[model samples]
Target: MAAKRRRPAGKGAGAIGCAPFFVLIVVALIIQYWWVLLIAVGVVALTVALVRSTSGPARPAKVPPPPRPQPVVAPPRAVPTGEDLTAQLRAHKRISRVRDMQEWDYEWIRLAHPGKSVREVNDIANTHFARGRSIGINWGDPSAP
Candidate 1:
């Protein structure tokens, strides 16, 4: 004869039976300890509020510091002024005049004797320079005049 199936004895009814009782106990405890639950919730809310407040606004990934100011200093030389400034300007003008005269002399020589090479121009000017010196007059270079 085949053995008839027997149900597992205690497992079925006991676990199912305990669920409502457990739920009823938890509901009773919650009613009695309501203030504790409130306090726990308040603590969690306070922690979240503090964390958010302390975090503040989002910041840039990297911030470069402002550059340091450099000390402004006068140049290491004295500023030319008064007679010194005048002399400096006058010397520059005289040098410029000498350059102008030399340029004019070359142009004049080139025009006066067309087809003369530069070497011939130098020779002509040198030959004429000593002639006017005896008369206390400068020649070749019109710079002195």
Candidate 2:
């Protein structure tokens, strides 16, 4: 003959037993005193509300546009005036009594042959200018000033 066996409690049976115990404990706590549980729940709820309000989500920072380019400054002499300065220039030319000269009349020489010193070139230019010659000056290399 086989031995008889007893069945284990099921999921619903455990929950049903727990339900009665939970109700009895709650009733006992309510009968003993109710304010302690109420105050504890209130405090927990207030703490949760405070945390949510204070530090829940943050927004991204706004970035500004790059600085605009500053306006360029012109030389004081180049600034145009409301009046016409051409008449003044013409009057100044008349007073100076300068004669128009051509490129061929002036000597087409560079300080000396190639690779002259800066002092020698300056002296040559000064000499020619003093003689009233229209100098056709050029740098050896186009890239030079």
Candidate 3:
């Protein structure tokens, strides 16, 4: 007859094999003093909770409230001077030669004139230049004329 061979115990198999032994010991202890076991379990739970609370980081006492916003006050509009107007007109002429002026260009012009449209500003600048105004801009070009 051949002798029987035993297989090596695995990690899971060893823990599973010892489970019944541990359960039997616990059963015997519980049978002896059930109240003591219950008290021990409660004491362990309280000690764990106490250690966690004491060992962890401390919290802030109180959070600060958000600040209230102040009311906005717009500054007064500056009055454009004659020299400023002349400089702006010259610049406008140069820009108009390159590309057709946009709404933003007219809006900028309206900043100086307050209520004039793009066409009105163009007419006004042309008439101002036509009347021999030396605004440092060349108005002799046939394309512009």
Candidate 4:
């Protein structure tokens, strides 16, 4: 013989039974004093407002004043001496032989000829390097004897 299936108890049954009870209570309260419903709605709105206001950081009603601008002052420039210039040139030449010169090389040359453009400084530096080469200045590998 096959076993008979027993139904699951009290899942939706409790909610169905409580629904009528809740409806009756609300109806009784409405009949007794309608103003109570309005008061309940007002209290719910007040509660929501209080919760939202306290939930996060408070914002200012007006925007804060724009930040004050800081003054920018230029530092004093130092002039390179003849010995300093010669030393810098020698250092630059040693570096150039190792690798092809870049924009930074022209920038270094610009430090010596302050008013000159990058192209002009490059030309001037190239002339100096060429002149050194013609004079047989050893601007190659320092490791070489």
**C-alpha lDDT values of all predictions:** 0.76, 0.61, 0.67, 0.69
| Residue 119, model 1, lDDT | 95
> Per the 3 Å backbone cut-off, how many clashing residue pairs does candidate 1 have?
0
TM-score (all chains, Cα) for each model: 0.36, 0.26, 0.29, 0.25
lDDT of 1 by residue, 44-112 (tens): 999999998896678878978989999998889988999999999999998787667666765676688
Writing each residue's lDDT as its tens digit, candidate 2 over 43-137 gives 99999999878965677888898899999987688654545577777777865543322222222444243576656766675676575555332
* Least accurate 10 contiguous residues by lDDT in model 2: 98-107
Runs of candidate 1 exceeding 4 Å displacement: 1-75, 126-145
Angstrom error at residue 107, model 3: 23
What RMSD value applies to candidate 3? 14.5
Ranked candidates (TM-score, high to low): 1, 3, 2, 4
Candidate 2 lDDT for residue 41: 94
Worst 10 residues of 4 by lDDT: 133-142
lDDT of 4: 0.69
Deviating ranges (above 4 Å) for candidate 2: 2-22, 55-57, 61-145
Ranking by lDDT: 1, 4, 3, 2
Every model: Cα RMSD to truth:
13.4, 13.9, 14.5, 16.2
lDDT of 3 at 132: 42
